[model samples]
Target chain A: MRNVKLTVAYDGTNYHGFQEQRGTGLATVQEVLELCLGRLAGRRVQVTGAGRTDAGVHALGQVVNFDAAGWPIPVERIPLAMNGLLPGDVVVTEAREVGQDFHARFSARAKIYRYTIWNNRIPSPFNRLYSSFWPVPLNDEAMSQACDHLLGRHDFKCFQASGATVKTTVRTLYRAEVIREGTLVHFVFKGDGFLYNMVRIMTGTLLQVGMGKASPDSIRNLLESRQRAQAGPTMPPQGLCLEHVEY
Target chain B: MRNVKLTVAYDGTNYHGFQEQRGTGLATVQEVLELCLGRLAGRRVQVTGAGRTDAGVHALGQVVNFDAAGWPIPVERIPLAMNGLLPGDVVVTEAREVGQDFHARFSARAKIYRYTIWNNRIPSPFNRLYSSFWPVPLNDEAMSQACDHLLGRHDFKCFQASGATVKTTVRTLYRAEVIREGTLVHFVFKGDGFLYNMVRIMTGTLLQVGMGKASPDSIRNLLESRQRAQAGPTMPPQGLCLEHVEY
Candidate 1:
């Protein structure tokens, strides 16, 4: 049985999330993908996604995998076939045949996420759905300087939201950057793996540093404290995007 | 009565157009703005827009003016007030008190429009509502050369769609250029004015050249013929955006 891997992209505005909540009737990216893939396979197929993104969190390069033992369709044409059957909000960008043992989540080395912010007094209507609106001006320099604290290996428990039962709270963060173009601010993160709502909380903490409410050094103190309540609030899902999944 | 000018931005997905059709009950940017402005004035008011964008056509810097005599609210704070009352899809980005004789349409010297195209085999879900999908390789160099034929004063009757009642079809095209960044191709136009669907038709004609189905010189031939049928099909409205208005 050959495993088929798919690179997916989706606008999460109308979806509950990437994870399917069976019997709950909440629309999700995984449910729609499985439905389309199942039809192609002629049997119910189980699809596994690389990330469990929340509602309103967009993705540019989400990854998924499923066994295609019964599906005789060429792997190259899978993208076209899935796109034809899938809704407009979700699409398969690329498809390939992989080893049977390959796992979409476990085989991933790192993931990249981007958080977009509209930094302006008046919000942009065109960007409202895709970006978070910050009415006050932000100090991008200060924000970038604060991102340094998140680099390298660290216990990111303070940045994580509640309800996650994980083996460890430590993680290796390879890169974190704040890039600004005109009125739009992009906070980019690349890490081995992120905890639940970790990127959002880090972004919120950086925003506080940008606003001068918290000093850049405060991030180091927050890390030492490892207290969830001490960290900044989690940013909205609309501003967060799963940018890439590296295997 | 004081004349107030507004720089507006809208998503345009839910709007019929920029112009108000009194009896049609079709929701439009003009109609919504007037409703919100009337409430502020505590009386009826007429609004004049610089451009009448079509359905699904976005605007980044649409200009509008209204007589706000009874509205004694501070002009500097008008944007905040109007944005509060307006829907999430529409917003007043900037507001100012202008000269009494200043007209949003008549006083405009030039307008800039941008048509965005996702030039790739797989359409981006995030860009679906904002850009046109072209699932083929486009020769951007050829398309850019074709844009040169559209520059300078010309009777754009061939590129115009029917149903426009303008006094003349001759308009000065200040700039026409095709810019590409990754999988996104942007067609930018700066002109004294445009005929009905002129930019869209021009873009479609250029696309044909980019696809090698036609030559760049055909744009000159189409202009000389002055026959709408000889040009090209009008591009979808969602790909078009009014970027700016210069007075």
Candidate 2:
């Protein structure tokens, strides 16, 4: 058995999410990837994705691993071969052989998610699929200051969406930042792990701070409360991207 | 009668083109705009587009003019009002009253068109809608040198697609530049006017120069020949954008 790791990228506009909901008849990134790879292998192939990105959430560098039992295609040519079989919205960017011990989800050290916001009064027709539109001008400095409270290890239950059955609500964030370039506001978060809707909730909270609706220090209080109701509204999924996964 | 001018933007993915084709049932940007704005006017509205962009071509600064007889809505709120009626692919960015003599197509003094090329071996899922993908490494310097040949007045019949009925094949270009931004190669062209498929053909010819398939000086020979067969193939319309128009 050969262990193969793949770095994937997808538009995610038409997909339900990255995870496959078996027998639900819903389209997903993982389901499509497995369908194409299974056709190549002439058998069932199980793919383990690093992140279960939500519907309409794009990805630049999502990692995945699968057992390539008796697979003959060389690692280098896998991308071209798989891309031929894959749909236009999904593409395998890189493929390589990893050790048998390597797991795409468990072996991941950290993940970086980036959220894009178009801070303009006029909505962009081209960016309608990829970015969240916020007409009000954001105070990036205030959003930056609020990001400091999210760093380090903390019980991030407030940011976690309801129905998430994770064992622990705690996660460690190495970096969290709000970067502004002209009318575009970008929020970057690098953490050991993120719960369902964690990044989106954090981005929404930060946007509230930027809009002067909430104090920058209110993040600490919200974290201390551990109540999802106290957090800001969940931002749209289109603006959030799984930017990178560190091994 | 109030003559009104509007600047529009559209993704162009869903439209057949900008011009209205009578009874063809093909969706075009002009038809959609007129359908929405005519609803506001409660009568038939004829929209004259500055550029009759081809199918799948985008626009950031497309200009249009129509007669607004006895319309009561303020010019400033037209964008908001029309955008509500228009589909998600098109939006009116700006609208204002224009002189009676002003025409969106005939009064245009200059126009700018931009073509985007993704110069990467691997296809990008995100750029699929807005860019043309080239797998080979491009020599941008060669393309830059080739752009110089397209500057100034020239009988651009060679670049014009066949079956185009025009009184004069001569057009003057004010600016032509090929800029490289990492994996993205952008071609910018500003001219008094452009023939049908002129910008796309020029971009395809320049891509040949970038790929070393043709020399930079071939542009002059193609122009002098006045034969469309001598020039390069027309690039796809998705990468072409009507960036701006000057009256």
Candidate 3:
């Protein structure tokens, strides 16, 4: 059998999420990819994604893999062929053959997530779907100072969403930074692994610091407490984007 | 009686157009604005727009004027109050009281229209709703030369859509230029007035010249012929945006 790896991008506005739910009758990114791949392979094909993003979360470089033994189309042409059958919101950007043992979810070394905020009194019409609108002035210097506490390895239990069943709450954060471009603030995080809603919770907490509601030093106590209640509220899913995954 | 002028912005993907039709049941930007104004005024109100954008055409600084006599809300607070009732896609960026003689359509000195082309092989998920995707390579020099021929006053009958009745087809062209920004090509036009579908049709002809299908000198003949069939096909409405209306 030939293993095929694909890099996908999607708008994620009309989708339920990345994972497929059998009994819910809801559409998902994985289900759409599987449907298109099965059509091209002339049989049922199951695909696995690198990350299971929440509903309304967009992606620029989501990775997925599937096995096809007797597929007629060449590996390089799979992206074009799959894009023809998929919806306009979802597109396969690149496709190639990979080793059989390279699992999409297990072979990932790091993931990059980006959260966008429109920091202006009047919200932008073009950025309505892709960014969260914050109508208050933010101190970028304070937000940057808060990012220093989130760097390196730590127990991120305070940032994890409740009811998530992760085996461990400890993860290594390779980088954390806040960038401001015009009236837009971008919170970027690169980590070895992330728990459910970790990036969104972290963004909310940093925003609180930027707005002067919390001090940058408070992050240290929150991380040490290891309690979900100590962290800020979870930001909306529309502002979050899975930017890339490195293997 | 107070004459209120509003500078509006909207993502026109879900709207039918800027003008309100009597028999058609489709929702329009004008209809929505009037609905909110009437609710705030406790009486029926009508608004006149500077330009009548086609279906799926966006706007950044569309100007509109309405009469508000005996209105309860202050003129400066109208934008904030109306925004609370309008949908997320449409917003009134600025509102001010104007003279009674100031008509949004009649007193306009010039209008600026912008057409965006995604000049790349791969379509972007973020720009799907705003730009028209063109995969082929275009010669920017040829498009610039074509724009030069369209700078002066001329009869634009060839650029007008069929069945559009206007008092005169002769109009003054203040400026026309094509600018390339990264993977996007912007066609900006400023004129005293534009005929029906003039901007879109002119953009189509310029794209033809850039693609080597036509020569830069052909525009002169196309204008002199005064025939709609001699011009290139009208481009789609999604790429056209009413950028500004100058008094």
N/CA/C clash count, model 3: 0
TM-scores of the candidates are 0.95, 0.98, 0.98
Model 3: per-residue Cα lDDT over B96-127, one tens digit each: 89999999999999999999999987777778
Per-model TM-score (chain A alone): 0.98, 0.97, 0.98
Off by over 4 Å in 3: none
- The true-versus-predicted C-alpha distance at residue A73 of model 1, in Å, is 1.9
Pairs that collide in candidate 1 are: none
Winning candidate number (DockQ):
1
lDDT of 1: 0.93
Candidate scoring better on DockQ of 1 and 2: 1
- Per-prediction DockQ, in order? 0.80, 0.77, 0.70
What is the lDDT, from 0 to 100, of the residue B144 in candidate 1? 88
lDDT of 3 by residue, A224-245 (tens): 9999988888999999999999
- Candidate 1 segments whose C-alpha is farther than 4 A from its true place: B163-166
